[model samples]
Target: MDLTRTKALPIRHGKPKVLKMLLALALLLPAGFGIPAQTSYAAGISKPFPQQVDYPGMIKPSHVTQNAMNKSVSDYYDYWKATYLKHDLSSLPGGYYVKGDITGDPEGFKALGSSEGQGYGMIITVLMAGHDPNAQNIYNGLFKTARAYKSSGNPHLMGWVVADSPKAQGHFGSATDGDLDIAYSLILAHQQWGSDGAVNYLDEARTMINDGIKVSYVTTNNRLNLGDWDAKDALNTRPSDWMLSHFRAFYEVTGDAGWIQVIDNLYSVYDQFTAAYSPTTGLVSDFVVGNPPKPAPEWYLDEFKETNQYYYNASRFPLRVVMDYAFYGDPRGKAAADKITGWIKTKANGSPANIKNGYNLKGTAIGDYATAVFVAPFISAGTADSANQAWINAGWDWMKNKREDYFSDTYNLLNLLFITGNWWVPEGQAEQPIINLALNKPAVSSSIEGSGFEADKAFDGNLMSRWASNEGSDPEWIYVDLGSVQSISGVTLKWEAAYAKQYKIQVSTDSSGTPVQWTDVNSTTDGNGGVDEIDFSPHNARYVRMLGSERGTPYGYSLYEFEVYGTSSP
Candidate 1:
């Protein structure tokens, strides 16, 4: 199958007479990106308009597309909290987190505590700040839980596992991946909410990066050690432990040049591994000897029934490496991504069904299930190349009806967060797309009454408050003053038990005041209660409102929070 990749070439946007071709070129370029140049509004005078890309290519995610992606992120987080969060605050301490599957059975319930998940929990918590109002609390709990499992080997590092008194292993060695993300999430949390809060995110992030993660790096080979205890094993490294982008973050936080060496050596060793074991496919082995650069036969022999293949740990390679190419556009990273993605594209024949979950070094399919965890990374890889557009679309189509098991469900959510453009970067970084925030905005309603069920309660940043009508009323509306006319992107509504079965989201400027003339932007007939995030065509509006024509419950028209999201003009 021949793939089509339209290279994004730069052209100046100017007078249409001669530059119509250029403007057309710009539109076809990629992701609805326009070329910025001096528009001659006056004599020899010009102003700058920066071009921003909305989606993966010429296409922008429609309201339905955006809504699905956003909901997937939100819903998955909710599931993570509901399914994985085991602590009953009544019995356990306020900040202590409980990890593992929540089950009532004896054996399963006993295994429902661990230090490993706190890293993942912290990441999911901080990332969902705007959507999850209790993000900080969640992070605080996760941090406390992780701190409780501090390894005796390294006081800063967390123990690999924790369980009920009977199942506790009395182990105190840090796992590399857990600490890596735990530290990384701290950086994100610092940038997201800052160090001043109860967590002191920045200071904590530095300690974890400088003292904990940095200690795991071996000076002998300029690579990551599997754990603090793996000092003797020169080349014993897990490919998944080499978080390419996280090392860059380590450098940023510590200002250490050593981290750069590790980044350089990581690719150098990766190139060596691909050249030796899986040259054609560029498939990374789960375990490898990075310094001398070969598969770790001992680990392969002991751990795997089938050795040195892309299985559980190595499967993360595409998502990790693709991130470097996607964010920084590093050439080596791109070449590595192309190698893996190109191979998958060739084998699958443009159908996601043909792809398997696990593979051998020579590209043999070891596991046949088309699991979401494995497919998600390849879909992310496709976003890096316009050539892989067909499969990217197919991958997304596949995810629409994708099965959701325990592992697949969580990874699928993280993957959705990544591939759908909801994965946030560190704050103040350039090239961040304009986001929609609705916290603390003023909300007014036509039928709202009483302080307990007031209209403004829906915009107070608390998800618990419900704005309810005085009576079971139809055609009741809740509108928010966005303060300025901004580019409206999407709307997220947290509805109470009393929801509107049919509702329309409307927006208008109304240069003059009193009552505003509203234009319907988006409408829904099948409104599911709990939470509904909707997308609309990008339009400018200062006042955004939701009009409910039909009530689902006889009690009233009610909503916990009505959020209007938009981006500022460039």
Candidate 2:
């Protein structure tokens, strides 16, 4: 695959030109000549939706019950799956394409689907394994379809657009965002169901990443070019394509430290752009061009007049940048996320409903009306800071039941998964099975704030409920009984606004023993309030307690959950 190949005409986001000559030639070729056949595989669900993954350093909406969040994702996915996901035997036998809407289509270009939509469909299906029984079959079909419409420049990369015909002529070049998502989704598929199946998803992912993506899309400077047809343009790049989490996964799979360079380069670019262009808001433009990258000129890409503003393309910046923080605990990611959330919190006056559709780099709203495409990503960004808890809870309420077009709806569903903690890293990496032994266990606290703030609420496995100690009290504690002696390796404390400045994890072999001998397993003096996972050498105990010595706030020490993890005593 030649990385420097250029075409006479550049392809816009979803609109592409129809090559009549290629269509004529494609009709003469035999059916499925280049496309691979779909083979049966023993693909089973390993990590399913509502995995309720505990992202190491991320926060979720604490104002709503966990069940409500899970239900919101399922409900939106059902509608999105029905409306956009389409199967067509016109090209590959088992081919599926996500149906696209005709919004903002150029005059000559008819709306079908793009590589972007295919990538979104693939990712959503793979993550939705347990919830959607037919996810595997649909995912296989989507893979086949993406493969059938390979890019003319590089077969490993899917073409950017699939126009009216399902034949090869319908596909035009490639887009960077779609290719990135498609490659990342394959890694996810390999992790969800092992690569022993017919697809060998891991192999395909490596090919796409190494041969296709690295060659055609990634430039010599380590910045992502617009698409395969960009001819390695170094100056101009799409901001939304700066997917830090995806790049991290790429580096993990390929061991290419170049991906790290790419990550560092993009972070630098983000900081530079935010400092220079949006000092206060930290908002970036849709397309950034040149060294010391600045916003693109109006009508620069021939896409739209607002190409330089934070329009549809750049609206996804928050979700893309924040995932690195949520998954990998990157401080840079958190810093970037906090900027967006912080600015938006003030802009919306702390209301999710006031979030506009688009904005300029200086934080002026380009559009007045609210849309899910813009709101959803902001909600995802809000998860980075505990200060935005109320903001994100309001965002979830505003976005959960709303309906929009294909693009907006799909983005909404994806962001919803991220916001609710349903989206997770693939299994081959740091993914681990999470089990909370203290869930629904008998718990007792020294004191409570009121009638609703009971000790059992902390052990009920609900984020919306918590156990609160008496106001301004020190030496307050809460403990949970495991019913029998068990080995405890780690504990997670999801703290509320009234968090403990200092706390100790103490355990006893017997809850009813005389004096109840308690031994300290872990102690922390600088305990910050978000989500803390304290790990230690395994200890056997029937009773575990959180003893607070100091309070972080004026109120009591409140905890949303007290989770214990370990194997049973043997």
Per-candidate TM-score against the hidden true structure: 0.61, 0.68
lDDT winner among the candidates?
2
- Provide backbone clash counts, one per model: 2, 0
Off by over 4 Å in 1: 1-64, 89-92, 95-98, 101-110, 165-170, 298-301, 400-403, 427-570
Would you give me the overall lDDT of model 1?
A: 0.63
- Maximum-TM-score candidate: 2
Residue 233, model 1, lDDT:
39
How much is 98 displaced in model 2, in angstroms?
A: 0.8
lDDT of 2: 0.78
lDDT of 2 by residue, 412-504 (tens): 999988887778775333224455788888898999988878999888754435788889889999999988889889887877668899999
RMSD of candidate 2 to the truth, in angstroms, is 15.9
Q: What tens-digit string does per-residue lDDT give for candidate 1 at 219-259?
A: 46667776666673367677777777666666555544345
What Cα-based lDDT does every candidate model obtain?
0.63, 0.78
Provide the lowest-lDDT 10-residue window in model 2. Answer: 20-29
